[model samples]
Target: MNRNILKVTLLAATLGLVSGAAFAEDYRQNPFTLTYKNAITENVVGKVNIHAVNYALNGVNIVANVYTPANYDPSKQYPAIVVAHPNGGVKEQVAGLYAQRLAEMGYITIAADAAYQGGSGGEPRNIDKPSHRIEDIHGMADFISQYPGVDATELGLLGICGGGGYSLKAAQTDKRFKSVATLSMFNSGLVRRNGYVNSQTDTIQERLKQASEARALEASSGEIRYTGDAQLTDEQIAKLPFELYREGFIYYGKTHAHPNSTFRYTVSSLLELMSFDATNNIDLINQPLLMIAGSKADSLYMTQDAFIKASGADSKELFLIDGATHIQTYWNPEYVDKAVSKLTEFYGKNL
Candidate 1:
């Protein structure tokens, strides 16, 4: 049997007969990247209201991109949003698009490069820490309000993928935010440690074991080995469980390749994600919430589980885009109008 087929078969078997692979799966599709030449760019633009503002949260320098609405005004304050990007992603990715789009909708939006990745500061690149990541949201709120056009009182938070998970985590404790929302919100701790919905009973244990083993090697040789993303061939890519990855190479490899994006994250730090648990404290959040995901997203279940768990969430709604997959929402124009409209309505009503 071919390796691709073998891998697919094994993954399907591992997922059991439940068809876990079928949820509006867009994991293979790369969400559209922000480019100046694109037609849409003319609709959305950003002024460097703040550049490299350093927030020493968890001993890392967090960088943020703040975008104000088209008509400038320092005389009056406006609602603000703190947007966090996806895992292994940067500020220039999909989060920036959402931030800019929301700004165009009349809100001051700030997109940040999570600490230890992209433009943010951290020694070992791509180490995901639960608390630190949550604080990054708060730090973004802190940094953005200082800008001239933002209203400190009317605040909201948005996160995509892993950042979505961290946003959920942030909202639990920081009631300072008037409204909280997520796009394809993933429970970073659960998925990173358990492989989506507690499926891998030993994921955390196994991850810890591997980290321990890697530490021993570093101790002996003073050399660190980071396990990065699994590189796949075209043949292997064709059989990816999540089509998003297969589609990703087309964008990341050709269209969006950047000098700083060669990052493959440290393998030794995979265990860091195992320590994060955003859902465990959902009962503490007391705010209006909106959870949006494609009806077909395999990752949709995680959002469902989270929306159900959050306590004191009387003002909450879960909206699913029919026929849309997880990655397609990133920037396909596939469902951008619907997603953006729904968001505008939600924010317009609550904020």
Candidate 2:
């Protein structure tokens, strides 16, 4: 038992470091660590440690972390939120930071690893599936509300990067979430199928060929290599597909890097993502939706496009964070604060 505890502690430390590397801070400086060690107050009310779980969602056991406000009570229920981590991110990444900060502001925030990624259960680790990813959010909502001190009635969701699009899908179909908000929303499926809005179309033949080859490689080697986001050195980062990659690494690869995380994901998953389109049913979304993107982010167009198509949304708003890049919004104090303020106000009024 002592050895087991030691092993767990060691694993936690490693995971912590990895998460710290890719996420919550400037890698050139402190990297992402447990920086919010100071006092924080929120609904549950006190300083609480992050909790991990193997939650069953979408026929899979997904890993997640819940940040309950300090001073939690058994009697009083508190408002809660489901925070979906961005693509290639886990609960311990910046997503968790957002959840923790929101909890500090008096909400029960749960950030979860998408199915088949991070500590979550999926056959092919790091595989991105739209249906299952949506289920991950719904399942998080189900799990969080069931916790003893949480108010099941007051529920909200925040999705970061690719997670944003999935959150929209969940809100549209499940309707369990009273309010939904996104930060630097990336249309993963759309981007995969058609490069960056109208950039280019990757035909089905090539997609299938890639998936088929990836599957065979997995079968022969009994190992599935991932292509999540591809890591980069400071020099390589500068030469990435887009400037966002250079910046995204600061958020997900360096500052928030978790030992369990890799920039690479399963190539086969791209096929599914290419075909996936979270905004197809945007017209069906009725709950209040807040989509925030950086004005200068090349990815901004995706969120904007999604906002324009949603037909029946009674309360919907698209915010462009001035002078911010796509990934920079994750941990940027000014950007994140602006986002949280808007989110707090929205959930306060709507939820």
Candidate 3:
């Protein structure tokens, strides 16, 4: 038991460079180890990390990070991947980690904060409409495709968590993404409408009513309300019943905390979220599709459901990481390595 505990502790330290306790209380003091201890930086060898890139999308200024492979040269074209961050997440967290890893694997990658959240410019901040989020993925494809040394024909896409759902919707319409992949997919629309694991089925109508009311207030220029905005103590977070929510709070609210990651969306946004379904019209995606999820993640159902609905993809696969939970796939070294290895192979074959 002692050896097992030590192994886990060693794994966490190697992934994020902070002790488990510091993950909850001293995130800021840690050495910028959101996912990996030696994340790409300006001075890093074999990789380059560009920050605060400004781009226009539907009249909004979007902030994004672009990662280029080692020894990248503009004269030489390269395959690229656009990574979409999870809901309430920023470009600097899990998205950046994958972007960096992919970059190291010889693919140019971009991870952008959604238009209305993080460091991006949008009014009534934290608005989490599905259309807007889907547009963000499309926007990344547009911006990154034109970047120097990027071969537009070989472009690929990866979306994590809620972003995974949006990617499915975006790839359905945007053929620019030659290959599409999702990690630990979260069906935001299904959850918002029926609740996690269908636990709120009885409250569906009641919750829709609240969403309607919130939208009405927004239209009338009244105070904008928000949901999923809670301030919980460490103990409270630890005691949360669901592993996804519990680990999410620790990742976005504590250990991997960033100033722009609030993890809240305007309550009115649910009006759109509830009505949007990523699996709707999923058959339009004819490109290669890869859906990855943790074997033990409760959220695996989302990936499976979406994969089943994506009938039009000529080539598709569902890969699962053994012994991992949803959030664990984000930072757990063993799981992350497995996920990235699979992604590299998928993109290498498809793109």
Candidate 4:
């Protein structure tokens, strides 16, 4: 299918106007439409349960899932963690997996869809602006901190993929997060502005000009242009240059696909994305920090660069999942287990 047709299909699915055996097959096991392995099917007494939630963020209705620990008690205090989803990802994917996993480890955790993406409310859909993305993390912190039984003073953060970069920016000024962590950290701004591995450095100005034109077009005629909305064939996906993109397609497009998740973002968003860098104010985060990435991930350099520049962190550590790739850290059983174990250790001590 072409990009425009895919967009129409997505819009139809979102509006409940489309349904098929594929949708039924994908979501039959879980009423919540959670795609993770071993997802919670229902709320059982004295067991981990997920609460679907929606809250207003600057007039946009942000959709999220809050996972309460087993035998959760409202009268008692518990540390909370806010989980940010990856770019083009929804709360029901890997973010929900980690949130549920962390809740199982005895912390109240939340995973929310970012504004203009996933199930969240926003116009000019898929804006993908850095400022809005960073605020989504803060909004999650705000809501989760006030949840029943939550100890407002004890809060942690976990960002995956593109969300990792926004989390870094959020933790810089949002001191409410006492502990911060990232898995398979991806610097979205760096990659977007400079292209993956700086391969598009020569075309930076040319692309910026196109973004400017897109913005102008939108302003004058209310027309929105999108990018990165391609539907690639399996053979085409296999030929992608980067392992992150190659494996990512299999993860997000097939095995764990959710109708709400997508890659399309307004082309005009590049106006803001090109000027933003996650590591710009790295020295502002004074909390304990832990960053984990796959040792073999093509994206490892991003984690290493950010780790080295986090000079203001009270303490910091970089962990590598042996023999794992970037996307593997998201869902591979061994890698996910390793990442979660380290996160439990980090948040346990810090939060």
RMSD of each: 6.7, 8.3, 7.5, 4.7
lDDT (tens digit, per residue) of candidate 4 on 91-187 = 9989999999999999999999999999999998989899999999999998998899999999999999889999999999999999999999888
TM-score of each: 0.81, 0.83, 0.90, 0.93
lDDT of each: 0.67, 0.70, 0.80, 0.86
Worst 10 residues of 3 by lDDT: 9-18
**Candidate 2 lDDT, 67-182, residue by residue in tens:** 77767665888899999987767676668768877887888788877777777777866676787788788888889989878888889989988789898888887777888899
Question: Total backbone clashes of model 3?
Answer: 0
- lDDT of prediction 3: 0.80
TM-score of 3: 0.90
* Clash count, one per candidate: 12, 30, 0, 0
Instruction: Give candidate 1 regions above 4 Å deviation.
Output: 1-59, 197-199, 202-204, 215-222, 247-263
Give the distance in Å from residue 325's predicted Cα in candidate 1 to where it truly belongs: 0.7
Question: Which wins on TM-score, candidate 1 or candidate 3?
Answer: 3
Tell me the RMSD of model 1 versus the true structure. Answer: 6.7
Residue 5, model 2: lDDT of 27
Cα deviation in Å at residue 162, candidate 2?
A: 0.6
Instruction: List candidate 4 stretches off by more than 4 Å.
Output: 1-25
